[model samples]
Target: MNKKKPITPFGWAIKQRLTELQMDQKSFCELHGIPPSRLSNLIHGTRKAARYRQLVAKLLDIHLTEEK
Candidate 1:
């Protein structure tokens, strides 16, 4: 039997925040200046670039750890 891995804490937090804000992918992408396809891929499990993550945290006004 294979076990499925959980999403990373950061990724999970981002997903939750997006849901809480009631923002859709297209709107989120536009707000963050990220390509729609790229944001979609990230939500689907692609690791977002570090810079993109930082920008996201700032734009969404979510506090991220220093390690982020």
Candidate 2:
């Protein structure tokens, strides 16, 4: 039997775009209204949630970018 581990799709996606934009955690948090500490945790993979990351994605316009 095989069990698959859960994935943090939103967090992973955000991290990717941030890297692409050459953005640091502080700047990204400031731009997105995310608490610095919380953003740090999320980016470091210490946190996981669909709703929060979805909001982050939307706020950062990642969803729109993905559509293009």
Candidate 3:
């Protein structure tokens, strides 16, 4: 049906960690040398690039948990 999907555990983790650090996604992307668009895609689970996923997780030091 092409319904919008929920944010993944990894995505939520990234956002949560960013919020904890009091940083915005744009700033986090810029600071980490990641394109904002790519980060968005990564969070939305559209970007399936393993390398980028690993880089983001490592850089953010995030542990993923699905919130309900």
Top candidate by lDDT: 3
Regions more than 4 Å wrong, model 2: 1-9, 44-51, 62-68
Per-prediction TM-score to the true structure, in the order listed = 0.61, 0.51, 0.79
Q: Count the backbone clashes (under 3 Å) in each candidate.
A: 0, 0, 0
Global fold similarity of model 3 (TM-score)? 0.79
What TM-score does candidate 2 get on C-alpha atoms? Answer: 0.51
Which of the two candidates, 1 or 3, achieves a greater lDDT against the reference?
3
lDDT of 1 by residue, 1-68 (tens): 75534555666667788899999768889876797766544444456566776777787677776432
TM-score rank order: 3, 1, 2
Ranking by lDDT: 3, 1, 2
Query: How far off is residue 22 in model 3, in Å?
Result: 0.5
lDDT of 1: 0.68
- 1-68, model 3: which lDDT tens digit per residue? 87656787788888998999999999988898888878887788876756677788888896544333
Candidate 2 lDDT, 1-68, residue by residue in tens: 74533334555777788788899768977886778866655555566544555677676677623220
Question: Each candidate: what lDDT?
Answer: 0.68, 0.63, 0.80
Residue 51, candidate 1: how far off, in angstroms? 1.0
